[model samples]
Target: MKKFINRIFLLITFTAFAFNINAQIDLDTVKSQKFDTGKMWSFDYPPVEHFKEAYGLETNEEWFEDVRLSALRLPGCTASFVSADGLIMTNHHCARRVLEELSTKEKDLIADGFFAETLEDEIRIPNYYADQLVFIKDVTEEVQAAAETGETADEKAKNKEEKIKELTENLEKETGLRAQVVSLFNGAKFSLYGYKRYDDIRLVFAPEMQIAYFGGDFDNFTYPRYNLDFTLYRAYENGKPVQPEHFFKFTLNGIDPNEPIFTVGNPGSTQRLKTVAQLEYIRDVVYRGYAFVYDTYYNELEKLKTVAPERAEEFEDIRVNIGNAQKVITSIYKGLSDPYLMARKKDFQRKLQEAVWNNPELKEKYGTIWENIEKTQTELRQYGPKIMAYTINRRFTPQYFSIAQKLVDFANELQKPEEERLPDYKGDKLDSTIQSLYPEELDNLIENTKLAVWADFMRMQLGDDDNYIRSLFGNNKGKDAAEYLLKNSIIDDRDKVIELAKEGADAILNSGDPLIVFIKESQEQLKDLREKAEEISNTTEIYDDMLGQVIFKIYGTSIPPDANFTLRISDGKLASFDYNGTKAPLFTTFYGLYDRWYSFNKEYPWSLHEIWTHLPDDFDMSTPLNFISTNDIVGGNSGSAIINKNKEVVGLAFDGNMDSIVGNFIYMPHNNRCVAVDVRAIVHSIDKVYKAKRIADELKAGKIVD
Candidate 1:
């Protein structure tokens, strides 16, 4: 009987493992095969030689400058000057949050799109800006040297920080350009970027969310995408259109078949330089935890949508942000699970190890680096849950919680010396950060709804037995506490909150405001977690910096650095590939889009908006809608201008094929495709569907229109 029981247990375990493998990418291959670094070619490491060899495109400094200057960086996405007179273009999803900010009950921008026939009609989004990259120079040697200026890790880190601050501040003063220093390839290099800021940005055009996002979450990052996914904004200086020195003219004729092209834009971040151990930890722990939390928030936001049906437009950012996070985390989790990706990573690690260990001097300097990283990562994983919990922005919280924390942190920091205060609250950013604490959108209904949801979520995360939660609720579990807090909370009143902002730290902390009190109460509960996370973070940061330098020592500039939301030029071609069983075309058309609509029975997400529902007889359905290419791209590359070597804007890159999701770790060129909205499709919509002919004229400035 005992033998039988043991055998049953063993059988159950085996079955579970099998199921896990089928459900996720097999991790068994993670350490055995050579992986591709996938090109997100940084400007610092210009791939002129590769461009010449692959596409016979010999680019000079002038060409690069034009590429860099034409590009603009949005708050969280990439954009480009599609026309002179400051006409900029980016993805609609990127503009969704800002649109929500400008939206009202009478003018539902999300439901019915908008088109500015003239500059007078353009909507100005408040406090938003677009930055153009004007100059960049390598400062790797200076930064790496700074890291070693002191004996202890703590001292070295401080020295490094001070040096970077000095470098950027001094450069900002000297050049009159906004200076930012980016650490690359872990710590192998640093680059100084100088950007010209454009503060007065006005929205010129945007498609309705239905047509813009199209298939929505179900088809977010997939190919054969029908998403319009475009938004037009114009940069203004002193209430007038600012003419940039360079911008790409639209390619109305669309792509020549199999034409070589380049995607120039800022890619947010990547972990290609991370060690296999780090990847493993992120795969097994970080991604899973993030995905779960994002999923939870996404679900909660969905519920919130149904409750305040009319205010759905106002709360759309929660859906947009949380939805995007879920997809990103889910994609990352799946990529980490991929056996082929892991195998390639493992092979690369083995080679990197062999290369370092073969030379006595190199081995002596870097031999234990990987081991140290692995050990630190193991320690770091111990506090992963706490880190996720403590990050207020990432967690689902009431508006009051985020605003309260910002104010609380700000009031406390105001008392500290300028240099000693937290970096975020010290710079030119402090004023804006404080101003954002009292946004005009914080209404009573939203506040009450958020408080209710937050309370329930807290109960779920912290549990009914938690001291602080119980103290706030007494015998009440869910709805009762939310009601009590909602009725009496002083945080909802913007004037009162601002008044509290003026109060000293002790006064604010001691206040009876439930939200403030809740924050105060969380201090002790989170102290141990914060300390552990900080310690783990500090050690890992130092070691990672050291590791970067060591990798630099070995590889030099042979490999590109990890992406740091800096402008990069990725080269590829108008391409097509096999997916599932069939070949995805290089470009898709309105014909296919109409077919999809019909195939879906003309329902919600797949339903055509009024403009498309009754198509014009003259409108050509064969116009290229979406296309796929082999260019390397990621989340931050959204709204990047895809252009041919002639510098004509052919398309706007908006998404990547499903295989490209693993691109954060590996490049599957054969299968991965960057999805973009063809210029013809964009113009077609503006000219025919939306009847925004004036905006189309801007796009057709130099080129002849049909």
Candidate 2:
């Protein structure tokens, strides 16, 4: 009986092995999808025929121009002109920083929400501006000609930079607009974009943070969200609202199931075009290093919250920002670890290389590009850890260390000849550099904790026995070393720093301050590493440009260029998909918002504001709040206008489902979906919850309502 059982187990094992072999995919035969690069169609080369074929929607240049004119690019996100009177619409989270800046001790605008009953009541945001893309002119031929003039890669890069600067200056002078040379497809295409700038932007209405970030970090980057993440502002010029030639009319009738829609905005960046080796470096080194720092800082901040309860709110904000970064890095890391996705990337690269090598002309020019990039990646892997260790990231490193490093640099620059000094230390810029050496004072407790965290990170990266680490720590641990440095360092004192600076480079270099000595010791090695990294970068950049040119030759505009924070129009449809164990709904309603609030037992993140605790009798609970669509979007797509074929705004693109996070490298159309706040919900909340009928009326009328 025992012999029979053993034979049966062997047979079963052999069967399982056979099944695994049969199921394994042949990655070599994996063909790249047409839309894998995404639908971020450039206005310079809109996918007119593709749109017509896919959705039977015939779009012309006029339609494209109108859409482009309607969109507004914010400092870090996207917005749109919703009314002809320059009434702007964007995500509430996008306005958080401006709100904090505009707030006062007596009024917390971010927490309590804000409404300008009249035009005069609107508050101007300082140093904030919105840019409208007025026109685009292709400068690829001129730029490429200049780049080809130089024999060496570094010389070519310098020439390209000079030519771009010259073109930008000339265009700005001629057009009286903010002209920028936008590089697309690496350097294969260059477009000079002219922008009409609006520096005088004012807040109109904003919802409370409670509703803006409804589910907090839990629901962020997830669908079936019920966030009222919308805000309003007005663009002013010459102290009056500037009437635009084109804007999207707000529509109360929300989108239908499977209805075609377009997301018009700027997408920050994507790495879909990155080679497999480059992706590996980012996965193993760059992003992993960032993740370590963010995770460590986040944990430290969380601990500080308990120890320093009085500064809970301040620490919470820092943690929230760090948490968001951690999520993005973690998502990208997971995507890189996905074997199937990496395999797809490999297959795509293989096919492209095959295309290049199959043609003798292309092969001769680009044959060794991949090999060279791999070599650069190897060098980067070696330098990445050292850079991460020594770099003074203001977020983690204490102000004392940053000041020490800056003072050291300042002293060294002062010692150099006038012409040899860096631009920042020469001419009128010297005062600005001196001013930057002293920043505002930070709480001692927080600074000490942050210093300890940074020290721990350095030790983990470089090991405890590293020369710099051993010298700095001496006989102490990370926390004790941080305390010793803080107690002994005079660099944090402005008067002492100035006095040391006046005494010359020798005084500053040998200041006896622990932080100063630590930085001075590592400065030479850091400088050498940076120089080597820069040389490697220049070489890789030229090779990348060649690779991009070959890709453009093979695929043309069929595959869109990687996003570079420029305006783009992506097409998709309102749809639902399977998630977890069940199908996610196409739309979430205000009823679901209350459900979340109740389910979480009225906790802080899921808790409602006092104003929203009791809804008005006439308020509609079934109003569509947030919805998911098949639209392609990424980070900068936040606050983008989600419009129908008629160019009417039906939703505001705010976030994306977890699956869409991987869209940074590959567009998985089957599951990746754009999360948007329905326009109806925005109008509904403004009219009912906040009772800001004036803004709602303006949105509905496409003008400022009297």
Candidate 3:
């Protein structure tokens, strides 16, 4: 027995030699999370060497551009062309809001699936569009050169801003495309992106909301998911279906464990490159406070929802947003609090500082960047809460309050020259701003309930003793105050609000609307707070921009830049990992989904669509459903195309596992994963179950499945 025990000890000691990071406990530090820079590779400079070395794929510029053009950028998600006739595929959740808006009380399209049998049956989404990146140029030298002409920091900043604006305008005019100057690596590099936009986006097909959000909030951010979260839409040009030159061909049985895959999409944002100090400030102060603000609203909404359970369905949109926000902030907070992650961040900072500060020339120019940022962050702690609560933009997000704020700001901006006005009040954007100044059609009862909830929360944030607060609330600090504003403000009266908004500052100041009066009285203090906040913000930007230069000087393209809601190609593999003393499967099948419905006793989220239960004999229960990949993703990557090296669509990214929630800062591929709907799953359901023959036929015509 003693000999056997000794042998077991020796075997355990040598386990790392056998399993390495795959070992049960992974004795290696978090640094063992190789490829942690978050493969959010940008178009400007991809890690071509790493790709070649890791995947044995020798890719050229043509290949890069072709892959880049294949994906389309949505307002809050990403999608891709799947057919030559511009059939686009994305996450079903991405189209949830649009579906909700289209639903009639009689025919709830969101509850029941929407499958347009004919092309003419497709529904158009107004004011919605998708952009394809058709043009890109490196304008870093010109932008930085302009900044160098300034005698002072402020002047340098202004010079840079003006130059960027000029460059964007000239590019737009030259190419007749929408041009945007994107800052990469903080401001170390700048690239001009020109997109070809299609305004006429239409709904193609959607699964029932129940299947799309199976397990709902409980399963969100967790792995072992069985959700079929795919949607199809189409783009049109000149009232005709667009024929896209580049698109991903659907591939069946497209994945294998540890096989290389790539996710092409816009990843929204990531703070992976932030300094330890900056992250600490966010973790300790910023995120916690922001989380509270969002949760307060959620709690209040939940309470109101409880009061009128019949209207519970009305709050889903905001509730989903609030839940997501809360989860994100809290997860980031938790990740930062992790001693191991913090230690890794600290070590990384120490090593980078050592390299940066040791080079005499680099040190002299950029040594103080981090210190300046730290100081500014401290100052920010003072004014951030105040500005967040009281600023015109931050204070009012709901349409009614937002309209009142916009009207007041509009009147104020009208007093200035076009160049001097707030930028949003300056160009084509001004017209849209003006048009949105009037409230959208709203139900009085629904508006009152939500508005009262918001009003009560604001009062709590800004105590009654506050001059503006007292003026707005008087002594009534609850629903009464909210009701009073609703009654007194002509802002709710669309025609009246429009007339006053057009009459300019004179009309606004003399108007007797209590909401308007409250805003006017608050403007002076708000202005002072804003100026202080902007000063710190501007300074911080300059320093961070300099820091970017320093980091580039040190790391170059070896590390990817931060995500900024732009197209980035992330490379990884379809893989599984050991978890909870067991193994996680690479893919979940339709069998598991059915099992879930039965096990949960057909409850709401777990309830299968009635059609699903009576599936045809041709339906394949063993078909792949959801799967996990090591791909790096963030919020806006919702509908990114997961493709193989041959550019064949394999899966559609929708969510990430809970461990990936920390991917906002660190990517632990050892466990963290991007969850996707298998391409076969999407096609299987449409063909065998929903009988979406038109879509299935189109897909089959274009498929390159093995």
Candidate 4:
């Protein structure tokens, strides 16, 4: 009996030690996940193939022909070639700015649905286009060759950049393509890219905002969602709708409850590569900056809501704005708070180090990459936050100051010789500013603009060393600075400011006032900010640059960055998982809306409208309303084609569950459910709810499935 007890104790000790070791290194030699049975993500159509396997398929010169931009850039964005002439598929919300320009009060296509039933009905959008990757080249050899010759880190980076640009330029002109070289990991490697752009995109179909954004902001990211935020836009060429061969057709039957489906879209950026030190800084400084601004805006929005609850529906847009801002705020806090994310980053970095050490060739060329990482960490900690905090505090200043500065610019231009002035200004640009600031619009801007106040607060707290602001306002105190702004600003009195512009038209411009003074003062900082910002912007260039470098250094081009929105595929499942300690229903119905309504005791927006009282009894809890799926996504992934194993479009990707927002930086395995609008539900809402069958049938979507 004593020996048995001793054996049990020994077993426990061994188990604990093994668990600790696993915790230290989570990666497995073989993925535990079985891609075949649980593979709801990859469709059978093209058959899933690893990049190398696919590359091997290129026999003879056909490989070069097949290796187009669309094929090379993988898992880039949730986009589709909707027409044969390169008409791309993306979200209406994604295309909101373009739609806004095409819309007029008489024809409110965004609020009301817009349909281009025929070719002539399509609306041409100005300066609206889709990005296509045309060429990709790995420039690690050239970059490393130059980097090896440099003494300092900065010199190494500069040398690598120059060599890469020279090499990429030669390759691009040789290929007759627009080429750019992107640098990743300080100066690890470079990626040369060529792009093809489709310029003439047109509006095809869009659901009304009420339908597209149903349940409004309150229901955003929460699952078993019932929103039908979907739109269809077409690409046009020479006044005709282009035919797209690569577009997926809508499937009426949808998919089985746990079928695999895939989505392809441009995921903006992911920080899965950052070292722990960098992430910690983000958690402490950058995230706090976001939270500070978000809190201020949230409070301001609440004030607006309280002041005008009578016109609550009118302020719906403001509420949406607040909700949108809050999601990122919540995500930042959530990411920082999640120790698992920090662990993942640490483990990934450790693996990178291991990979560096394991390869003798890598060590010879890279010369202590981990040491470089350590140095970067040390340098980043020294100056990163003060720099980051200073920038983040001014998130809203550019737009605000730009608008105000434009008014000042107009005043100055009026003072210039007539020939020197812009053609449209007519020495009266202030009139445009005054006319632009309508009461409702101004109120809306104010209601949505808590960031300005936050910025002032941040400046006061952190801007003591801000020589530029100190010089302009003559005081660096945020509060005092704000007060000075109110006193001297041309944006103060809407009417008087306009009148002055009309009176001393040239003097405002010629007076050499502090607006221009401040603007010029900020030039150096602004340039520095722009250059730094591009590093993290998650463009095709940045992605290629970073991932290509990592691959060249570590894995030798085996594992690629997920997708680049060209034609690369991704793998995911249609299975649901637990979240927030509750079993989310496979779907949400209008019954969920009623539940929230009664839960809030007939809240303003959630309460049933007089019209909704007529909803049929069967459209209650039993309705197979909204459902959760385990598809992966990120921003710029909207309007993606959510397809089943049969390669049929079952839904349109609109959003992800709120917990999934962190998928922006790191894709958490369990919570990254891709929230999409079921096609049948959308059709039912249009046909049954709004009685818009003509529009519904025009979409020609497949029949509904239970």
Overall lDDT per candidate, in order of appearance: 0.79, 0.87, 0.81, 0.55
Best by TM-score: 2
Model 1 Cα lDDT, one tens digit per residue, 1-706: 9999999999999999988877686555455422277677777777788778777778987887788889999988999998778899999989999888888988988888888877888888899999988878888788878877887766777888888998899989998889999888787778888898998999999999998888877687787889899999998889888887799998787677656888988888888878888999888767866665566556656676788888776566566556656787888898898667777787777878898899898788788888998998888776664445444652455677777676667767787888897776767877565667787776656555555555655555555786656655555644578677656667677877777765656677777776677676565457877777776666777778877877777766556677778898888887788877688988888888888899999986688777788988889998989998889998899989998998889999998877788788777788878999998999988999888888887898832133
What order do you get sorting by TM-score, best first?
A: 2, 3, 1, 4
RMSD of each: 8.2, 5.6, 7.7, 8.9
577 Cα displacement, candidate 3 (Å): 4.2
Between candidates 1 and 2, the one scoring higher on TM-score is 2
- lDDT string for model 3 (1-706, tens) is 9999999999898875667644444323444234555789998897689889988988888888888888999989999999888899998888988888889888687789799888899999988999999998999999989877767667878899999999999988888888999999988999999999989999989999889999887678877999989889999998888998898888885687756899999999888878877888777566755665566666666776778788776665566666777778778888888777776776666677888789999889988888888998888777665555555433324467667777878988988888898877877787677777875676665566556655655565566676656656566755787767766678678888877876777898788777787666666667887788787877777888888898789989888889999999999887787777688899899899988899999986688778888989989899989999899999999999999988889999999987888888887888889999998989889998899887887886773222
lDDT of 4 at 294: 63
With a 3 Å backbone cut-off (N, CA, C), the pairs that clash in candidate 1 are 25-337, 29-343, 30-342, 30-343, 31-346, 33-343, 33-344
> Roughly what TM-score does model 2 have, to 2 decimal places?
0.87
Better of 2 and 3 by TM-score: 2
Backbone clashes per model, in order? 7, 0, 0, 28
Top-lDDT structure, candidate number = 2
Q: Report residue 310 deviation for candidate 4 (angstroms).
A: 7.3
Error of 2 at 382 (Å): 3.8
- lDDT for model 4 comes to 0.55
Candidate 2 residues lying further than 4 Å off, grouped into runs, are 1-31, 306-312, 403-445, 459-465, 473-515
Query: Would you estimate the TM-scores of all the predictions?
Result: 0.78, 0.87, 0.80, 0.69
RMSD (Cα, Å) of candidate 2? 5.6
